[model samples]
Target: MVTSTLDRASAYTAAAAVLDPEVPVLTIEDLGVLRAVQVAEDGSVDVTITPTYSGCPAMQTIADDVATALAEAGFGPVRVATVLAPAWSTDWMSEDGRRKLSEYGIAPPSPPSPTTGDRRNGPVQLTLGRRPELVACPQCGSTRTRELSRFGSTACKALWQCESCHEPFDHFKAI
Candidate 1:
């Protein structure tokens, strides 16, 4: 399909609007999975995305959604590239995404400490010296939430329970 610049832009918009299957409350862009979007002169669409983690199962679904959205937008010859280099970080998550996560009953990731090294620089390493960060409860907006488990329904999240509401919720853990 021969798409104009405007149409290409629309395609990008549509692709960006694709929501993550694992986290329906967050879009691919919101999860920082969307890396690049390029519309070739021939009207072919190229989308580059990075997985949240190496073994993240949502990657395939995300790629498929990108292709489907672009095709629906009248863009043909769509190519979805999975870029592994420069690992994804919660830091890449947009402010709007954080807000949406919070509203969806998931606590957003806390900012990295200044003294710590950048996790993106090397392979994902779980550090022993890593200090536990406080997470607010999405239910009653209380800071008195306790982590029930390190792993949540998804790999990107941790199970947490709100003390005030006694509600169980997922917290988007910092990686």
Candidate 2:
């Protein structure tokens, strides 16, 4: 069975539709976790994914979901590979993903700050006390939000409350 370009694209479409277990509003592709998909001549499918973090608990479930989705779409022997090297970054999240997050009542991660100095050559600098990030309230769009906890419902999110709205919401932390 020779796989054509259409077969690979179909496989990718199937795999990319799998939703994140933690954030159901965003598809794996929208979250930037669905990295690559390839359909072999043998009719087997291969997928490569990068987790949001190294120890993310949702990776296995995500892998299974991708495999299942592809299998259901008539692709057999689906293989989902996890790659941690080059690490996943919040920068990879699609604009649509961020918009969906905001609509889902979770504040999307702020844009990553520009890197300064030569990170490769020098020792890492640690700031002991940093000011709290100014996170806008997803509900009220107010910047007067305070972080309630560093850890939220998940490792990737932080719990925060809006001073104006008095509503507590999860904020997707910038990686």
Candidate 3:
């Protein structure tokens, strides 16, 4: 009994459902990290992924997760490929992904600026009035928080300490 291409495609979809280990709330698809899935004529599955950040250690784990999921779905040979050309951007994050990140206690990236002038100045500068409020404490929703470190458990996040709750948490750095 051989599986049809459609069946394999369905399997690929299912296999890709596994969420990122670091941020369990978002699946690779939601993060726009899962670039492509190809099922060869011989039943081999190839999954292409672009990491959210270069040199991110989690990419290996994510690849392994993809391979494991495909194998469990009865794909005899699974190939996980990393593609780096286009580069991953927070802009690729989906709306659902943003909601999931916030629900998971991390902030999501803000929408991109409308003009290219926003980028020519090294990093975007926010006028005092236009500046966004400090990220609230994810555990308690308290606005009384201070940045403890620019880098958190991951490069994409920053460590913050809640003055009200006295707890340390990660804030997804606005890219």
Q: What is the per-residue lDDT of model 1 for residues 79-152, given as tens digits with 9 covering 90 to 100?
A: 99999988887777888999999998889997545654555666655677757778899878898888899899
Candidate of highest TM-score: 2
Checking candidate 3 for backbone clashes, the offending pairs are none
Q: Where in model 2 is the C-alpha error above 4 Å?
A: 112-131
Colliding residue pairs in candidate 2 = none
What are the candidates' C-alpha RMSDs? 2.5, 3.4, 5.1
TM-score of each: 0.88, 0.89, 0.76
Worst 10 residues of 3 by lDDT: 115-124
lDDT-superior candidate, 1 or 3: 1
Query: What tens-digit string does per-residue lDDT give for candidate 2 at 56-92?
Result: 9999999999999998999999888998755677777
Query: What lDDT does model 1 reach?
Result: 0.85
Global fold similarity of model 3 (TM-score): 0.76
How many pairs collide in each candidate, listed in order? 0, 0, 0
Native-vs-model 2 lDDT? 0.87
Error of 1 at 143 (Å): 1.2
Higher-ranked by TM-score: 2 or 3:
2
Q: What tens digits encode model 3's per-residue C-alpha lDDT throughout 5-42?
A: 78667766866697898898899988878888887778
